[model samples]
Target: MKNSTLGPPDSEAHELQRNLSNRHIQLIAIGGAIGTGLFMGSGKTISLAGPSIIFVYMIIGFMLFFVMRAMGELLLSNLKYKSFIDFSADLLGPWAGFFTGWTYWFCWIVTGIADVIAISAYSQFWFPDIPQWLPALSCVGLLLSLNLLTVKMFGELEFWFAMIKIVAICALVCTGLYMVVAAYQSPAGDVASLANLWNDGGMFPHGAMGFFAGFQIAIFAFAGIELVGTTAAETKNPERNLPRAINSIPLRIIVFYVFALIAIMAVTPWRDVVANKSPFVELFVLAGLPAAAGIINFVVLTSAASSANSGVFSTSRMLYGLAVDGDAPGKFKALSSRAVPSNGLIFSCVCLSAGALVIYLVPNMLDAFTLITTVSAILFMCVWSMILLSYLAYRKQREHLHRASKYRMPGGIFMSWACLVFFVAMLALLALEEDTRKALVFVPVWFVILGLAYRSMRQKKSEGVQLSYDAD
Candidate 1:
């Protein structure tokens, strides 16, 4: 918001000042890019692709990097880009904006539920006797309160949350590297080598099917990559800091996923990397490190909590935005004294509390988590499609942008089309797969709900206009 504005601008023009510092923006980007999916699901991926899983992550990372670059370009072009939804609506038309904004809200809301399940389930690993619902409820309560603070406070919280995750992963990579070197001449008599990668019945031990199955698990690892774009509204230096963060996507994938996975595989063969356990903590134990399980558990707990915090933050902001646009109850847009979207935050958190109830009813959390994750992934796809549509629209209407499109997605229009095709294929694949098929059913239901909500909002708007005209 400009200093000249007497108070906040009109709700539609309600700008999020670039108050987030460089460090906060960088860490927030990382925090969003990494999630519980990496630590909890990595072992499952290892089982699917053996050591070849690293290659799967690399491929996904390359594609996602291009996507982020495209988003960064559009956001950079317009200082008024409140969020991706604003850009989407302004460029891709009203339908695109409505779908994108609501779908993103669903993405985080579902993801938050999944994180709650993980948090409760992980807590059981430490305290097996405790009721799962108890921890889930408690965590939901804690993070809900934390997120009801100012946006700057939220940014600072994410900063530390991302820092912890970064430190944990880097330490794991470094420790794994050391273990591999040490294992070469150790008494176990297994010379630590890249050969270990193939020792478990070769790289494609499970064959072509296994490689394809890699996507099943690998997709979860890339769950939050789009999260970087969500923070554009809050970044301190959107032009400078965002480019710095977006450019690092490729490097992070290489360093954290590819090289780190290689280091772990070199030390321990795929056969020994137990599919049911965490590959991260398992590496520490393999290296003969003490208390590795506890350490990893702490990191995962904080990771889950951090994500929940963000879920509350993003969903609230989106809802508040919608409310201002007359798409939701006017009450939701009201700010607390701290300038926090307190009402919206509470609303989303209360919805997230449903996880605790579900856990109480169902013995297994995995089924619920999987279904929600699929829908969340689909929602994220919708958000991405909106982004591409926005970019495409912006290119046609705005002539100046054409002269300076250096960072255009590779293959230009072709890659955009390719990505859309890939997303459609992904949806089809979800139906083909047992775990993700539920979203095929659920996503359509979500659109129906959104359609009804839009109609109701339109009715309300028309009535308001009529009342004003009568008074005039």
Candidate 2:
């Protein structure tokens, strides 16, 4: 890890515009918390964990709540800090900032690739003949164009995207409740009742290993939940809105994740759910609303778009931050008059265009999605772990700031350690499956590459300095 003596960016010169209002921040946070994972991947999770998948979601959401709280406190502690990456670089070291900033950028890049692949898969529902890479490539181009307009446009895009997701979940929960109350029976002969949760092999049909299988996909589902922390720079009122957004995680998790899973399982037995299809669509079908299934498909298609949109915004911002710290090319540090990172946005989109190549080569879409998402989850874990580690450092070095800060992390340092332990357990679970283990083996290679890049960049900076001395 190379330590940087460079000071923070000039506060007024490089500051991102605060264009995201309260409604945008709220919806962005909601959009971040709920993603394609719930809309598309829940079927696989339900099949693997049986009805116990509900507990899987709850536990994951619970652990991440503390992570957000730590992030909230850190972002609120200093107005100069743009995001977690900003504060981590300041407290932990320059190396921590360089690694975390770039690692987070790569995390979203991997996630964006997964989202585009998902978009292609979902588009096949409407147009089967279109090549998977076509929709994938088109999505990147479209989002890149929208992102370049202004920061507020990005907020509006997420706003409507999140609205579609929230409406779809609400519709499912309402329809499921109606079916259970009316004693509706599905074509598969399962009764719509609360008993479906435990009666089907007592919620742990596949036993301990089955329960563990849920972690690999479930972790990916929660990958974008930390998007709130990234918007601290663009938020109109960080002191009020940031805390409000972070504290609402429990409610959103319960409503969007926990309740949605329970409702779907109750309407359609866990055994009847197919791992390869969207459970949301299957639930509407089970309820005899076949026409509504198409609408559900459309909602999920946009859900993938939403997640990918977020990936573009996050990756560009991370690159901008990295550039400001001298870790990346200074061209990326130049923001447009609109205060959007135009160069950074284009660079990320160009890299994201490779999602098309991955889709073209992989042959099997499911295998491609699995490999990409698993690798993304691993990289995100590294970013999350860095946030927790930064929190520990903040406690040790900035105790006075912690005491004086209005938004302090609850459970203090103990919860931070516990979250770290929980992440290790999730990694162990990911290692259990062959496909996921392959991704696990490949994750460290990214860090090694990053290390080499950092060393080379450091050497170049040193050479430049020595030449200046010789000339003098």
Candidate 3:
């Protein structure tokens, strides 16, 4: 029964407080699992995969469950470890920690940028004249102000943000069900039916390539699902709350992702769901809701803002962890009076503002967004791969720990390998698209930068030793 504000007993050396309660953790998990990926990106996915996109979500969720289980077991095995970055560093090596921590930070920055960009685009729905970057920059500032507060405040904010997503999805699911049952007719004159899932093109509407493309887009929706893993140091009762959150992934996927997709497609044919606009918004309009457009618009705006808020929180924590491990600047290690990583939070927000410049520089915001998302997805895949690798190392080097642990990854080593292979397959799938292919090409540039930075730090340390010897 330790006081959460005091943090874990072994965490006195750390500045972050364990102020997140079970309710906060649970809602954070739900919110993290749901993102604008569903609201904004689903249109493109539906256009590509057709109704089969439903299965894409389910399959990805199934595979990622094992990944989450691996993460959970690793976190529980060592209470001192903050997140996957710490475990990866501990189990694998310092290089693994550096790479995972910074890469994860980059993942969120890219995602945050995308979310901001999306916010600006969504804003144009009502205020068409306002520069897109204005809203994007404004959103970042707002999130930065909120995140500067105590960790409990962050939890509260995320709790409500996630609740909004849950309510929106529930509304869509419930409304779609009623429509299907009542055979609701749309403005397009199409009758609502579950059979719309298959009748159009037998699942592969555009062909194998189209179905394959779904994997590329759908994977992004599950990006923030691992946000729960990052809460290891911040969550109270990790043993109980962490398991509750991680175990609920399947249910969340089924209800929020799978059922929502099914509901949308049932109300509107997959082919008819435009790729350029949100299917959720489109569905409400077709359902004859008088204020459908405004309602969905508000939901989507908040959804993007929620994702951006998460990005700021995650990037700051990752930066804090990196600074503590000497992977990043020492200043990021400093926490505010409230125990929040104030410096890291500000740094991430500053980087996030670059998205506005991107919008200004790149005439086609859509292309910029696609590239940013692809990059984020690639970086996240690498982080996920590292987590799996760390698990394998743990089993080999710390087998006794596994035996003593209460929570264990199901399917064991075999599933871990399978998940790795699946990730590789996803990278290949991502490469199929022209835009995403560019992301794969650019990923190595980051590793090159890290390699040089590591070498320079090593050289500096060597010089310092020489100086000490001369003085002696």
- Candidate 3 collision pairs: none
Expressed as tens digits, the lDDT of each residue in 296-340 for candidate 2 is 878988998999899999989998888888899988878888889
Deviation from truth (RMSD, Å), model 3: 3.2
lDDT of 3 by residue, 18-123 (tens): 8999999999889888878889889999998998898899999999899999999999998888888888888888778878888899899989988988899889
lDDT of 1 by residue, 408-466 (tens): 55555666777777767666666766767766787898899999987786677689889
TM-score of 2: 0.97
Ranking by TM-score: 2, 3, 1
lDDT of 3: 0.87
Q: Which residue runs of candidate 2 sit more than 4 Å off their true CA positions? A: 1-14
Off by over 4 Å in 3: 1-14, 465-472
Candidates ranked by lDDT, best first? 2, 3, 1
Over 4 Å off in model 1, which ranges?
A: 1-15, 184-191, 404-411, 470-472
Backbone clashes under 3 angstroms, per model? 0, 0, 0
